[model samples]
Every structure is written in structure tokens, then in C-alpha cells.
Target: MGTTGVRTDRLGLLLAQFDQARETAQVRLTGLSDAEYLWEPVDGCWSIRPREEAVTPRAYGPGAWVIDKGAPEIPASEYAEVARQAAGGMSVAKIAEDWSVSVERVEEVLAHTGEPEPDVVPVTTIAWRLGHLHSGFAGQWEWSFGERRREPRLMVDFAPSADLALERFWAELDRWRESLGAVTEEQLDTVGFSQYPYGSDPDDPFISVLFGANLELIHHMAEIAVLRDLWRARFQLPAH
Candidate 1:
């Protein structure tokens, strides 16, 4: 079946619906507790449960702290380290490549670390946060296109508290939506978009990748929400 046969009007409407799902996904975890964050709906299954210590996507947002000894969460220092690297024109791709991380990974760090506070900051504090973001999205996007690749050998590993991960994920989607505002419809049909590493195909139109992204985005959002609900119930927390 020819892909171009899809109606543009329908596509827009579909995207809008996907947008709603995305919004709902983000809002689903507005109020949750630490215990609830770890609550599992079923036995032996893990949810995207956000923990204070849980690392979500490749990012570290506000309130992240690292003050332990033998420790990395030294915010001022890490900030300076990242800042110096950035000011020295350290691009995400370069960072990823240098650290044996994928380009998508670098992007995740940039998204989560947020300019490294313009100076050195704690390396340990947001380490998990940064790793999760990079790994999850990179893995997910790869899965979306059935073009999965070798795993990224990142510099660190971090998992967030389920709630925090959900929150950060929601925020990341918001970031995507904001960024999409700058994407043109013409661009949607344009060829060879590099934004999606494994998802975008050179032979396919932009709309095709857009369609795939639409589905992937909504699906992940729903998966996350369900994970939240399941986690809450595992702890006997009220779903309402």
C-alpha cells in the first residue's frame, strides 16, 4: 500500500489526537508519593515508576542535588565542568562519540543537563537522570523503526523515582511540542530528516516518520501512565 495515500487533513487530526494523549499522559502523575512511585501493579514487573532517586530520561532537572563524599553530586563543580566543555564548543555529538555514547545520547544529556548551570556542577547528582533519558529514548526510537542498534556504552547509569521520571518525561514531551512549533508542514513531507536516528528513513517522506513518531509518542505516554497506575496499586495506593 502506498503511504502517501494518507490524507493530510486526517494526519493533522491524528496528530492532534496524539497530542491530547500525550497531554493526558503527562498529567496522569500529578500527585504521587515515594511509596506509590515504587508500587508495582503485578508481581515481578517494573513500572516507569519515578523515584526521587529514580532516573528518568537523559536529563536532570531542578532540585537535583549531590552532596555526598566520594561523591559526584557536586553541583558547582559539575556545572563548571560541563560549562567549560560547552564553552569550548563541545557539541552533543562530540560528547557522545568521545564517551562512546550515541549521538541521540548526547542530545539526551543536553536536554536533561540543561547547559550544566553555565559552570561545573555535581556529576553524581544527575548522573542517573541523564543516563535514563538517553538510554530510554534512544532505545525507543530504535524500536519504533525496527532499526534497533547496539546499546550505547554510556559513562553512567541512573534510574529515577517513578514519579520524577514520569514528570521529566512529560516535560520532555512538552519540549518536543514546543520545538515542533518551529517545524513546517512542508518539512513534514521533506525527505531525509535526521532528527530520528533509527525511525526516519531516507526513502520515506517526513510525514511517514511523523506518523511513526506520533504512534510511538502516544504509546510511550500511555505505557508510562499505566505503569504509574500499576505501581500505585501495588502499594495499595488509591488510584484516584
Candidate 2:
């Protein structure tokens, strides 16, 4: 096969996978009620919440609702370990290895300077998972096809309800599909075809970015589906 044929095949496979995942997600989302969408089955599950109720250091959205996102503060006990490690002359790398965390995490802990770890993936609700998928698509679309100037957090408005969120989510999915549809054979092979700032999109071939995006959709949608199942079974009697 020629180069053009290979590109067409690759792009075709990506679009097909995306479409399938979208369809599956839509099916899972059918008749999703606001209660189910916002249900927090476990303690500290991240989900859409009123702006005033948001616990994250930074929440995304301009509306009454916001997504619980952003780096969580380290706990006081965890920070005490950092202090202990530091006083013991442990290198940042050694501390990170001992904690099974990244060196950057160790640095952040050290730089935190004894601040208490704030009470904080937190099993996310359907709403939070959907918001994440929406952000991924919308962010990629904005950077790759739109003005390419604004960050996605600034570009998206968090939906306040299940219906509205689904509406906006579908719209972003369409935009993403349209953008992918326009990629040329040469563009797929070109590095930095997608200038999305959040990930390594700008450093990799467009095809690699496409595959990653598809993977995100597939996995997140499956999670949403499983959440829906758990929600439905929450009130059911267990089998003996």
C-alpha cells in the first residue's frame, strides 16, 4: 500500500473508533436523571457541585456549577513524612522513591513549607466523568481548530444539569469529529498538528494524538457506563 492509502486507513480507523465510542456513551447516558448524574455513591467522590460548594483549590466553569478539578493539597501527615525525610538528609529523589511518588511531588511537598494538607481519583460521579470527556474534546478542538489562543478551562462553560451537560458534550464531540475529518494525509504524519497545550499533542504526530484522544473517550465512556450500572443496582438486593 502507498503512503496515501496508509494515512486514509489510519484516519478511518480513528474516526470509526471515535464514532463507536460516542454511540456507546450516548446509549449509556439515555434517560440519565439529575440525581443519578450527581449521585456520590462513596465519600469524597468528585462531581459537579454548586460553585460555593466546590472543594478543589481551582474549579472549572463560569456558571453556577463547577467541575472538581485541580491538584489536591497534600495532607499534614504526608507533609510530616516529607519533613522527616528532609531532616534526615534524604535527597528529593530518594524521598520520592521511598514514597513511590514522583520527584516533582517530593519537591512540591518540600516547597509546601509545613502547610497542613487540606482535607481532600476519588471515584467520580457520572457528571464529573462526563465533564472530563467534554473538556478533553473541547480543549483539543479549541487548540487545534478554533482560535488556538485560549486555554480550554477558559473556553468551556460547565453545564449545570444533566441535560445541558449532555447537549454541550455532544456539541463538542461533533466539533472534534469535524476537526478530525479535515485532517489530510500529510497532516496526520506532521508533528504538532494538534497544538493542544494540555498534553504532548504539540510534540507528537497528529496520528498519535488522535489515537490518544480515542483511548480517552473509550475508557472514560466505559467508566460512565459502569457507574450507571452501579447506580441502577444500588437499591437492588444482592444475590445469595
Best by TM-score: 2
Give model 2's TM-score versus the native structure. 0.77
lDDT tens digits by residue: candidate 1, 1-240: 138764357445656765777667546656655555444444433233233443323333223431122222223334344445556676755554444556764555555643444553222222233234434444433433324453422211333454555555555555555555555677667766423443224435656766665766565555556655555455475568
lDDT of 2 by residue, 1-240 (tens): 356664347888889888888998888799999899999999988888889999887788767888997664345566875777688676777666566568887788787754564554378889898898888888888877788887787666776579998998998898889878889889999988788876557756888889999999999888888999999899999899
Model 2 CA deviation exceeding 4 Å by range: 1-8, 72-120
Span of ten consecutive residues with least summed lDDT in model 2: 113-122
* Model 2 residue pairs with clashes: 74-117
Query: Judged by lDDT against the true structure, how good is candidate 1?
Result: 0.46
TM-score of each: 0.44, 0.77
Candidate 2: RMSD over Cα atoms? 8.1
Q: Where does candidate 1 have its weakest 10-residue lDDT segment?
A: 65-74
RMSD of each: 15.1, 8.1
